[model samples]
Target: MLRRSAVILVATLAAVAGAVSPASAGGPRHVRGTETIPVYDYGTAIRETVWVESPLDSDGDGARDRIAADIVRPREARTRVPVVMEASPYYACCGRGNESELKEYAADGTVSLMPLYYDNYFVPRGYAFVGVDLSGTARSTGCEDVGGPAEVASAKAVIDWLNGRGTAFDASGARVTASWTTGKVGMIGKSWDGSVANGVAATGVRGLETIVPIGAISSWYDYQRYNGILRTREYVRYLHSYVNGRPAEACADELAAMRAASGETTGDFTAHWAERDYRTAARNVRASVFIAHGVNDKNVSTGQFGLWWDALAKHGVERKLWLFQAGHEDPFDVRRAEWVRTLHRWFDHELHGLRNGIDREPRATLETAPGVWTDERDWPARGVRDRSLPLGDGTLGAGAKGRGVTKTFTDESLREDALVANPTAVVPGRVAFLSAPLTAPLRISGEPSVTLRIQVDKPTAALSARLVDYGTGTRVDHFRSEGVVNLATESCWGAATATDDACYLDTTEVTATADHAVLTRGWADAAHYRSLRFTTPLEPGRWYDVTVPLNTYDVTVPAGHVLGLVIGQSDPQFTVTNDQNATVTLDAGRSTLTLPATGAAVTAPTTPQSITTTTLPGAAERRATDNTPVVPLR
Candidate 1:
């Protein structure tokens, strides 16, 4: 990764070196916007620390809150240039990037180790880079509201300062302004940091020309719950501590307030969650968006990005996407050179108003596997068709059942691995249905859904659908690893500072060659089958047609691979414990599994212990704690 970046950097340097004037001191000239600005040398860029004032006082401190910004910009610029900013709460705690590098404060109270390679790579390219510490984090004041208005406003305030609409101060408390910036900013980050960009963009902040949210959260509600089913009852509280890194006592009131606001008890979409949901305000977004997400991201999940992308499209917002087959990870790790070059061009077009023709390219780029990427006009590719496969006697077919058949499973405690392991295994806690080995490859490009027509014995039941690809093949092992192993040797991607090195260990992790891979999964509370904000309990002996929507995915199933759909009550690895072990009776005649298959046909045949139709008794319906600054791998 470093070697590739070095090559790109060397080329970039050569281009800039030729542009330098012979009479100029150490300044290089680059044509951006309407001016030929004197760019500061990469090795001698100005690094400074300042505090940008924010409008919120979330911590309730006597004074107004401030955001800590570590900025690197061209020292010899005669005029303002564009700015690249990253706002994050993780800097003071879990650090940033795959290496988990933290902020280092010099004895003079200036900062070093400014997270990722953004500053190292962009500062010399004639852009001012600002690494902002979100409120109540690192050197900033106020509390972290996760993705609420306070956090959004804190970051927005920095942009305002750069545009001369807000105030900033130096170490001596002297007023400072971003006179070196053109007031056009491009925000980029992964996970929570990226979410900040999403949140701020939804507010339609003026100076923010574009944003790149990689593995970012579009809705905090989705991050903690799925279709009204709680993914983790304590995730918000856990995240509060995880990002703060301070003693619990320091932010007791803030944490308490966050837990109460989450409303995990009912898993409803309250106004509190609404404040953190960017999709609800997507129409107000003025910035062009470049989104990247891992299709197999279990942490922030792909649904967040998909829903946000859809919203942006609906509002006619210019957008682009990079959908990878990896888990919660930054594209810089997966596609280093290409990611950097594309991102550079994207910023140039958006912030500098350069006619790079990037907006004319394909709207989406998808990775079928590691090292295999393809471009599409849009996501859920235009010509894909929904292939409806009905449940038959141990088979998936297009024909309706002649008689009512019921498949039952107890809502016993079981993990995802146990539920998806074997196609022939008649698991006590779940029911598995498989399609016949595909005669040809089929690519699934969008959300898949299942309709279960059933009557439950109890009032509530948790429904989990696992879309599995059962075959011996080398697939993207997103569930088990970061997919990269650290190499012993080191290399550099950007220019380095004395205390903050721009080099990271060149690493690689091989994709797992496994017999089976869990392609996509989704879960919902039967009560939430109606609406996420409202719960409707089931009436005993009465049939309810429940539609469970699975996660969004982009994958091509290999020929001869058996596509299987496993439905059950609980995944012990993901959801909170629910003790409602209700027997679920499925009317196979009325039930159907809908999938977005790229090709035309889909079929299934009977195997031992496979689903078969007949009148049957109704059965029961079911269902990383580490203090190590665990890297958000996806």
Candidate 2:
């Protein structure tokens, strides 16, 4: 087994060498000039030659793209070494001069395989690390369709090369060898590389071990479109940033073809996208996996995590999820340490027959706010109890205190609580709900659901609910979900002359025509206030029933933490245009909000079990530890 000191040495070396250059009195040396930016010089190290180019013509194409990677022996000269392979479009040597910056800022500096350094971390750790620039990208020759068949085949071919080299097996190719016995290869990458990891895992190639795919989407369609809504901004920007200005016009052409085939300047989730969706691909993955996502990531909705989680759970695939507070950038140190430990533990047990205590970690490690991490036995912890409070008049409270009370008013009374315009006022015209002082701290670790029974005179209506946290007069908006229901669907009739209901309603559904749609609701936080919001069109003589589910959350309220729920017609942050002139009524008896609960004390729910080697079927060893850190191999 590899020693802990060795592992820490490798990590520290990689961090220091890759993270920054030795600071000299003269400041730092400047390197390459790209985009008018000066790149800095980082220290470098020499790595032993693991493999030489040994070519093969497997397809009889007479091409030398199929070269077996020379297997590098582990630092400790172990018999079997775990492997991690990464294939990318980024030229391996492109960032050779900025190894320090690449290591420090790019994907949390763990991806220290850039050609410039020549000291790939995986090779030194006794793990065979393979880097191939997929055919047609960089030095490789062939059409680069991204995740198309060529990419998948190339991945399989790499596996074939590994197997053929006799590195993963004996000379006879019949059994494991002392040089490389475990015969497991994991995939690690981000963006294009991350997407290919999933694609390759879906190929069902043998010896393929675990996968860590960060910030990559499986299907191009689901990411660009949701339901029927068209997401034009983010997708277009991504294509422009990565695909444009490249010397390889073929890559750009492929992207153009996809856009042309979709036939919309702004792409919507067409039938084609749904067919190649990642959620569907997730169903075919057999290897254990971990996914990391950023909650405030505007590029991709955090809901994508839920989609993958739900699919894997349904398929009974062993998987884990980690949510971060950072953006699309690599996670912080605490997170990076956890990731390194996880990868080491997983690969150690599977590839080296080490009994490191990895399998004992929780299935999910969620980031509650910035620095807080919580462990759950499974996704969506079981038996989430729901509690509902009422909204009435200007006050928010429990039970009948605010119920059955209608403060009837003339135009003057309505003016006090309402803002008038062709559409409703976009900001500051909403009411907030506050919960009574808490006896102890309460935490919510799942999604929130809300049901509102309302009365309005208009034929069509839209309502939004927002959850907020109040501290020192600063109201921080947390989670939000909206429901837009046509008045006709609720059996209420609008004026016949009222601008053709067909234009506002489609197939009996109310849809948001603007960017601030109800579908765009969800956020991740360490804690939340016991708060609720109610906003809708006000009309004379009609009542409506509505329900909206706020985005999922993992909240921990400290003891004596005051809970406040605010109900408002509109939030300034989300400006809704074209508000219909109407009056709104709230019925307390028929309205309720549900909060998550576990039948037991809120503080003490069932603890989750960690993944361990013992739980695995054919394990050669085992270790027990009380601490959650990965057990060092020695």
Q: How many pairs of residues in model 2 come into backbone collision? A: 34
Please give the RMSD to the true structure for each candidate, in Å: 5.4, 19.8
Per-residue lDDT of 1-634 in model 1, one digit per residue for the tens? 2333545555544453344444334433555443233345655678799999998777776677888899888787666789999998887777788788777776877665677788876776678899898877778888777788778999999999988999999989999988788899999999999999999999998899999999999998888787777776677776766677444575688878888877778777777788999998999999999999889887777888988998999999999999887778888877776787788789878887767788899989888777788999888887778888898654565543415678877787566666776666677888777777788888888888999888888887888888988777765555445455566875555555555546766655357676777788888888777778778888989989888888888888888877888888866666764635878877776788999888635675644444222211111111132111223423
TM-score of 1: 0.90
**TM-scores of the models, in the order given:** 0.90, 0.55
| lDDT tens readout by residue for model 2, 1-634 | 1112333443445453244333234321211111000121121211221221223322224553332232333333323445677666554323211111121112422223333212233344445555555544444444444455555565656665455543332223243333443457777665556667777777666777777766565665544542222343334334433422234553555556555645243233444354445677666777777776554333444455566667777887777677654433333222544565565556555554455555666777766654567787776665556755555443343532555754321111111112221111222433334444345656665556556665655533334455442221211111211111123321111111111110111111111111111112421110011111112223456555556555445455544333433333322222221223334566655666566644222211122212111112111211121111210000
lDDT assessment of candidate 2? 0.42
lDDT of 2 at 263: 25
Indicate the TM-score of model 2.
Answer: 0.55
Candidate 1: residue 88 lDDT (0-100): 89
Each prediction's total of clashing residue pairs, residues at least 3 apart in sequence or on different chains, is 22, 34
- Cα lDDT listed for each candidate: 0.77, 0.42
Maximum-lDDT candidate: 1
